[model samples]
Target chain A: MTYCVGIEVDEGLVFAADTRTNASLDDVRVYRKLHVFEYPGQAVFAVMSAGNLATTQLALARIQRDVDDAAPRNLRTFRHLFEVAEYIGQVLVSSQVDTAGRPEFEGISTQATLILGGQVAGERPGMYMVYPLGNAIASSPETPYLQVGESKYGKPILDRIIRADTRLEDAARTALVSLDSTIRSNLSVGMPIDLALIRRDDLRITERMRLDADTPLYSDIHANWSRKLTEAVHTLPRFPWELPQD
Target chain B: MTYCVGIEVDEGLVFAADTRTNASLDDVRVYRKLHVFEYPGQAVFAVMSAGNLATTQLALARIQRDVDDAAPRNLRTFRHLFEVAEYIGQVLVSSQVDTAGRPEFEGISTQATLILGGQVAGERPGMYMVYPLGNAIASSPETPYLQVGESKYGKPILDRIIRADTRLEDAARTALVSLDSTIRSNLSVGMPIDLALIRRDDLRITERMRLDADTPLYSDIHANWSRKLTEAVHTLPRFPWELPQD
Candidate 1:
């Protein structure tokens, strides 16, 4: 299980993902789920994956190889964000197909879902969720976010806080908060979170870093959010039958 | 789909359930998921059901019939709250068996899960979640709440706020907030929630009420919670890279 989220606001795009992966409880491993492909001031793409680790790694390796070969259909050659998303979806499907062909892989799923967020030189910054079925859906102004994997626990905060006009930094913070909510409620999602922010029209990654459980900034956000939530709960209106406080 | 939660705290027990039931989107209906069995001044039990509607109705109908007949294994004859939970689980299993025996129901499931919370005369107040397999688990001091059906969206708050020493009214309000979160995040769980409160050693329900989306009290809680949450988000510490505000 994993929790990854991407938010597209007026200022730019924000992406965050947890780094824990496990075949089973005892087989837990920490793997980087956020991958960034940057062409300096020309174009930059951040891809965060969830689901089958082998399939994701295969697709990512192929993507890196394509970029290395300067392939015609590679991420660098894409003119629009959606085209890049479509190529990622195709790569995901092909990777799954290749893995599933082995007789030993019977009854195993090789599906991987990904969030692709970036800007091409000539296009506006955009975000999309690439599905395992070789299809993708773009985020909209009304719903300025895309999430893949263990999404529900973290969604309420996103639904309440995010907007198209939200600042990039605020969106990043909100994404972290959303990821924190998911990590707290679910054991499968753990820390050493990767976060990336892209300012609109910058055509380059603005801020990209990994936050572990003990990272001061992440720890401060977690502690403060928890405290504020508890304080907020205490401020809820009293039930009608309760005696007024003295 | 349904959402029901039961919380056991020092003051007593809090129970809540959403009323929406549907076979599909077009087949939606409102049905009470919370039921009470009370022998005034002697004992009271609140049972919240989720899953197969027919199985739940049959189990509940049989429980009523058993009480009517004063059967040896009926809820009325139970000495401990766990015994009543066991009786309910057996009734549920029997109901599923009876329904599944028909040829027309061959491939269908008639399973129902329930939360039973109340106090029997000599024991402390208790809450048990009866599984479809006819086994039940009670709430413990460390985890004072149990939830069933479409439960994830509402769980984070419960994890952060609920404790063994929480006040009964606060617990009830927390349950309502939890239900509200689920309703917002899921279309399957919806309006007109049923709530019941039991005070320890009272041997009777202290409060039982239905809260629809429009109920002023429920509406106020919803509005206030949303506002407080947004305000809380604003209070979260800013990321170090963020520019200082004027």
Candidate 2:
């Protein structure tokens, strides 16, 4: 399982994902689920994946192959961010179909979903969640964020904190906090985490860092968030019964 | 869908449940999920339900009928709280089996899971999560809470705040907060929550309250919690980039 989140705010896009992947208890492995495609000042794309490891790898390989072959249609050829998302969705569907058609993979699911966040020159920065079935939907100004995999444990915080007008740095911090909450509650989503930031209209990845549990910034955030949350609960208005029998 | 939580602490027990049930989007109804069987000074049980509404209704009806008929075994006849849990689990499984075996109920799930929390005189107070399979597990001191239905959204807070030594009033407050989180994140779990608290060795419910969205205590807690959380996030350590880049 993986936990990946992408947030689009007024200042930029924030992408965060946990690196743990496991086929079983004894087969856990760390695999970077955050994939980035950059063409310098032309465009930048951060694609975060969850589900079927092989399917995501194959879809990504096909996208890279298209870029290398200068295919008629590819990530580099897209005019809008949604176009790239659509192409990625198609690749995801094709990969799942090809895998499912194999006799050896009959009962296995080859589905993978992705969050595409970035910008093309002269266009607004955006984020889209591409479905395994070859369709995509953009994040709305109201919601302003997209998530895939082990999402529920981390969702209440996002639903409360994220908005289109939020600052880019605050969104990034919120994403990290959300990931930390999930990693604490669920063992499947572990660190090191991959984080990427793309400032609006920059057409370049701004800050991309890999943070492990021991990394200073990630550790501080985790410890402080936990302490603050505990404090928050303690400070909640006491029950009427707890207030003196007035 | 429902959201119900039972917390057992050294001080006693806390049970909270939302009051919304639906067969379809257009068929929504408010149905209390918390049922109390109190033989005051003898024993008391608070049963919280989630899953097929009809199955739960039938199971509760059977339990009530047995008590009224002075059955050989009933809530009033249990020696230990675990025995009551076992009786409830058997009732739940039999209800599901009977409903599922009916021809008209084919292709539909008749499952219902429950949390039974209470005490019989001379025994320690406890809580059990009874599964649809007629097996049950007690809430331990290490993990002193049991949740059913749409549980994930409300879990992080409980995981952070609950402990074996938490005061019963604080535990009740925590349960309400947990329910509030689930209600905010899930449409299936909603207002007019039913709450019950049993103080250890009392052998009777110490407090029972039905709180709605408009209830003053509930509303105040909601507003204050939201405000405090926002404040908590603002106070989280700033990212290095946002710290003037020194």
* Model 1 regions more than 4 Å off: A98-104, A243-246, B98-106, B243-246
Cand. 2 TM to true fold? 0.93
Give residue A54's lDDT in candidate 2 (0 to 100): 89
- Model 1 over residues A1-246: C-alpha lDDT tens digits? 999999999999999999999988889999999999999878999999999999999999999999999998897787888889889988989898545567887878878899999999988999999998989999999889999889999888788778887778878888888898899888899988999999999889999889988887788877777567767767777676775776
B1-246, model 1: which lDDT tens digit per residue?
Answer: 999999999999999999999998889999999999988777899999998999999999999999999888887788898889888888989888655578888867778899999998988999999999899999999889999999888888888778787778878888988899899989899899999999998889899889987887799877777667767766666677765877
As for candidate 1, its clashing pairs are none
TM-score for chain A, prediction 1: 0.93
True contacts kept of each: 0.51, 0.48
* Per-residue alpha-carbon lDDT of candidate 2 for residues A58-130, written as tens digits (9 for 90 to 100): 9999999999999999888889887888888888888885555778888788788999999998899999999
Error of 2 at A97 (Å): 3.4
